[model samples]
Target: MSDALEKAEQAAREAATDTAAVQIALAALELAKAAQQQPAPQHHQCDHQHKPRRSAGEWIGIACAVCVGGAGIAFASLALAILGGTAAIVVLVLRSMWTDVQKRR
Candidate 1:
């Protein structure tokens, strides 16, 4: 009789703890949703590096390609080169997105 009562009491305690934790998680989600409805703060970072959207690596690559490849490729073939660059960029971006989706699982 005592063993049965002890097991029941332990299971009841666990159930209560689980319920409390779920309530806490729900409350946190509600708070997050409410916060999102409000406007963001204006006292944001004003740094020059943060303002420009593009990263330094991207800018450097673009500059180098323009300086080096721009001379060799002319106006007639520029469109073809741009098409090739666009295709390469698209492949890289899609590959990254696919990897990210896989990692989520």
Candidate 2:
């Protein structure tokens, strides 16, 4: 009789442990489902895309670059003009020399 009573007590303890495990599994499943659900969006916020604002230092850097580029273009134009003037002067001197040679002939 005592052996039978001990076996019954062990069965009851095992049942209690299984019940607790089942409850924990159900709770974990509920938590997982809740985590998978997405939150609702608020209606008050605007969805328009925005450009990032430039800093003052960045604007100053851009201005400096533009000024330098313009100065470089101006110098290039001046160099071309000097080259053209030199070529014209050479042509005029060569024409005068040809005329002098023709008179000697």
Candidate 3:
């Protein structure tokens, strides 16, 4: 009877040791996976320089677009009004580019 009891006690100790080892191995695997999955840190640089100013023509273009949109809504043909406004904006952009080219020359 005593021999049987000693064998059982040894078996229990071995099982406990195996469980602890398995738990430790699982923890280490999880830690390794987490480290591998981490994203690299991002570095951002701040600019303190002054922003470029928009020319008066650009402001006028914006104002004309808003006014045209309002008139289109009032006339109950919003689509046509929006199309006209877009065309006007394109012309204004082209004119500004032409002026810039002239200035350079």
Highest-TM-score candidate: 2
Expressed as tens digits, the lDDT of each residue in 20-83 for candidate 3 is 9999999999999999899878788677877889999999999999999998778787677889
TM-score, model 2 to reference: 0.49
lDDT of model number 1? 0.92
Clashing pairs in 2: none
Give candidate 1's error at residue 56 in angstroms. Answer: 22
In candidate 1, which residue ranges exceed 4 Å CA deviation? 42-105
Steric clash count of candidate 3: 0
lDDT of each: 0.92, 0.96, 0.94
Residues 26-92, model 2: lDDT tens digits: 9999999987796766578768978899999999999999999999999999999999999999999
Clashes of each: 0, 0, 0
Q: How would the candidate models be sorted by lDDT, starting from the highest?
A: 2, 3, 1
In Å, residue 97's CA in model 2 sits off its true spot by 1.2
- Give each model a TM-score: 0.38, 0.49, 0.40
Estimate the TM-score for candidate 3. Answer: 0.40
Clashing pairs in 1: none
